[model samples]
Target chain A: MYKFLTTFLPKPLANIAMALWYFLLIIMNLYCGIAFAQGTFQYVGW
Target chain B: MRLLIEAILFAIPMILLAWTLPKKYVLLSQIIITALFIAYQSPLSFAILGTITFGNYYLLHKAVLRKSIKFVISLGILVLLIVSAKILFTIHDHWIIPLGMSYYIFRNIHYTIESYNGRIQNESLLFYLAYNFFLPVLIIGPINRYPEFIRDWQRRRVNSEYFSLGFQRILYGFSKIMIIGSYILSLKLSAIISNIDESKHWLKVYLETITVVLNAYFQFAGYSDIAIGISLLLGFRVMENFNFPFLASNMQEFWSKYHMSLTSFCRDYIYTPLASYFRRPMLGVFITMIIIALWHEITLPFLIWGSLQAFGIYLAFIFKDTPTSLVSKNLGRVFVFNYFCLSCVIIDYELAEALDIYKTLFFIN
Candidate 1:
């Protein structure tokens, strides 16, 4: 799927875009973790 | 959570100072910053870390030069510290687990073991303190090895590309924690799971299991990303803790991708040594997982979770030699994912409660 999405772009551009995609994915996870920790919500394991 | 906020507030000024200061003073500034940060967390934390830094330095100093019983004695002292700390945390309600105790203990042990085998040669007191108390990964860590961390520190670089990418990673981590982790799972799935006895819906049980897995991933990997990003901003490189673990097709692959640092640490420090000592890979695997499990928490459920994980790993190892069709591979992926989810549920709940949910999922209740 990733290959298909990047097939059209030049190699460098594709690499950069892939990097950005991964970056955002991590940021999203980090944001959720922080918010969860700060919130008064109950969670399972620490 | 408050620790994280305090870390950031504490780090900003130190970061600026390190960035603007003369090169020779950077290490000293980092040491001071780390000392102050740990002190701010708790005076006890400050004293504890100070003691640990000085103690490990002295022990490793003596241990690294030997190939005799004294080496054993030195290693024993370090292990004793970890074991006593774990025991004290369990038996005493008043014991605060000394900020970063788990992380730095593993780190000190790693250093001791690595240095014993001639993997690291540095004996610098300043570098040792700075490496272990590195503000970014001090609390939650990717667990950088002493040599690798020092190597990065010595040749630190702060280019615009690294700066932008580092900030980008930090933001991505925050998004994972605040948005996907909280909104998608904590608020919804946790609420549903807490009320599962009343619901008794198989689908909700399944969803809860899935959310448990996702929440664990986001929470851990998110912290790792933030840690790695902050390390990058500081012009030091910390190892990546997670890959795209959920996409992994088997337990072995999953273990390798998930918590890469800890897994590798166990592999290198525990599994390899024990396997050689005992001449049995399976025994080594079992012992390693047991240690890993116990490392997470001193509880019955964690032990069970570790046993389950070790079982999964053993199963994967057995199946590695078997030829599988594409269908089998897909089935394996599903099986592995579900197995992990169920085991995670076990970790979160009492055995009876967990089994009840499992029975409902199987339509037996």
Candidate 2:
């Protein structure tokens, strides 16, 4: 699946696309971290 | 969580300073910063860590020059400290946190072993303290080796690409922890697994088992990612911990992929030596897994889980010689995943209770 996606998109373009996805992930994580910090965001390990 | 805040508020400025500081002063600055962080956490803990650092340093410093029985004696002392700390601190008992005791002990032991083998070149007390207590990796470590860490410290960089990538990695790790690990896994799914007896349906049982196992993975992997990312930002190239472990096609591949550093540590430090001594890789594999398991938590359930893991790995080793087909490959993936999921019950439950859960998972109850 990853190979197919990369094959369809050019190398540099694919890199950009992946980087954008990570950027979105960062935004989502930041929102979650702040919103859930007071509620459910507890680390699950020692 | 408070530690995370402390890191952002306090450690980041020091990291930036250390990055821009002269090469010679960088290590000293980091050492002082890390020491202050530990001291701020607790003065007693700081004292304990200081004693450990001095003891390990003195022993290693002496052993290399003397070439006498100090090596064995130092190793024995470190092992004793580890055992005592393990017994003293249990999360369930709430006796003492033993803040970073496990990680620092292992780090010092690694330093001691490498020193005994003459693998380490610089035996500077400051560098040793800095490496062992490097504030970022101290909490959840990829267990960076002393030699590798020092090498990175000497030639650390702060290029645009590295800084950008490091920032992205940190964000990614935080996302994994906040979104998936804590919210989805812990809040939503683990709540169900904690009440497993409420469900009689096989599907629910399977779902709970898989959720619990994934919870364990995400929790640890998320922390590891954050630790590694933090280290990267601090201009250290710590080892990778997890590598798409859930996608592993076999148990051998799983171990090689999951917690790669710990696996390699076991391989290099424990398995290789034991295999050489016993002249059998199989026994070495069992012993290594048992040691790793007991190291996590000294209990009967962990022992059983470790044995199951060893068995899975052995099967993978045996199957490697056989002719492969796509069906067999997929089957191998299923077996490995299911084995790990089943074994993870030991993390939270006792032997009998975990066995009951297994029976439910198999629809035998």
Candidate 3:
């Protein structure tokens, strides 16, 4: 049943799932860049 | 009374940072926060906090038995508290409602649902209390589930690696919140958000909106970072919160990347149950979103945000299930997904403001 559902679901979902993995990879880089940004922060005031 | 004093005195130490003084003395800081008042400075706030804590304790204690009826009862109760707080706060303007009630509600829900799902067979009251009120993840969360939380606890008998790793995560998180999140707030760009007068230009609004999104990421993700970091300092191994969610290519993938613990929690408990609502494989995926939005405590803006996300997920479900490769590209998917998410954040601002901005974004204006 599970296998049949996957087969019938079409290729777009697979493409999306694959795209999502790639997207996560890109986000990892963006996150690393952002994490290192703003060398200092002021916790209290504006 | 306590919340007032803390919010007041909190300013001084926040500037000086009580956290910096002695990492080992966190227990003392908490005791000081608690020793301030019988009720939260405001009565309404007190009720919300008290009620949610009641929900957390109530659900957790009930989870220990592993009985089917009690298990069901616990989840139902936790959900009820979440909805009640959100409704009361939103429609009635009940401010200072609860400090970390929503997050703890998730914690409680996690324990209950995990017990019901057969993921958690063993638990003790002390461990459960610590997990729920760990104080680090308490305010903002990485949203720990009980089974995984229990496993981590058992495995953490006495490992310095845990401490070392935990501190690294904490310091990094604290720095993120303190440095990165704060830096954005301090910029003049954020000032435009508050002064949303008719004088505000379209370009300025656009700039402010971008700032708001960045600020949201930094502030919330920073909170998670702090939670992870502090939990580490205290010898608890809370899970990581953000996984570079912003770079997600599609809405579905973004959901998986962001607030991952909550996303999975809702997926397992709400989405799964709702999926069972009808036999159709393509389901009322948005139903899960309503639960997710309500998790923020049922405000109108939050409801809209949740609904918008549900819309995104529903669309993703349709697209993914259909096998449309054209819509799923690395750069193209990221633009669509984040644009969709940014649209939701716009709606989260205010209904009138959201409608106006939507008109402009869609070029209806």
Q: Top lDDT: which candidate number?
A: 1
Give a tens-digit lDDT track for model 2, residues B1-365. Answer: 66766765556876787778887787778778877887887787789888988887887685455654767777788888877777666545666656677778778778878988999999888788788778877866777799999898787776666666667667767777677877777677767666667555676767777876786677677777777777778887788899998778889899999988778888988999999999999999999999889877777778888999999989888888999789988887888888898778877676777778878776675
Q: lDDT tens digits, residues B29-142, model 1? A: 888988898887788988987897788777667545555554576678777877888878978958789888888888888887777778787778878888877898888788
Q: Against the true two-chain complex, what DockQ does each candidate achieve?
A: 0.32, 0.56, 0.07
Least accurate stretch of 10 residues (summed lDDT) in model 1 chain B? B62-71
Worst 10 residues of 2 chain B by lDDT: B62-71
Collision pairs in model 3: A12-B323, A12-B324, A41-B179, B1-B41, B13-B17, B86-B297, B170-B229, B249-B333
Q: lDDT tens string, model 3, B4-50?
A: 22443433442233336454343345434432332444455445555
- Find the 10 residues in a row with the least total lDDT in model 3 chain B: B1-10
Higher-ranked by TM-score: 2 or 3: 2
Evaluated against the true chain A, what TM-score does chain A of model 3 have? 0.45
Chain B TM-score of model 3, please? 0.75
lDDT of 3: 0.60
Top-scoring candidate (TM-score): 2
Off by over 4 Å in 1: A1-46, B62-70, B188-200
**TM-score of each candidate structure, all chains considered together:** 0.87, 0.90, 0.69
Interface RMSD of each: 4.5, 2.3, 8.7
Which structure among the candidates has the greatest DockQ? 2
* CA lDDT, candidate 3, residue B365: 56
lDDT of each: 0.80, 0.78, 0.60
Ranking by TM-score: 2, 1, 3
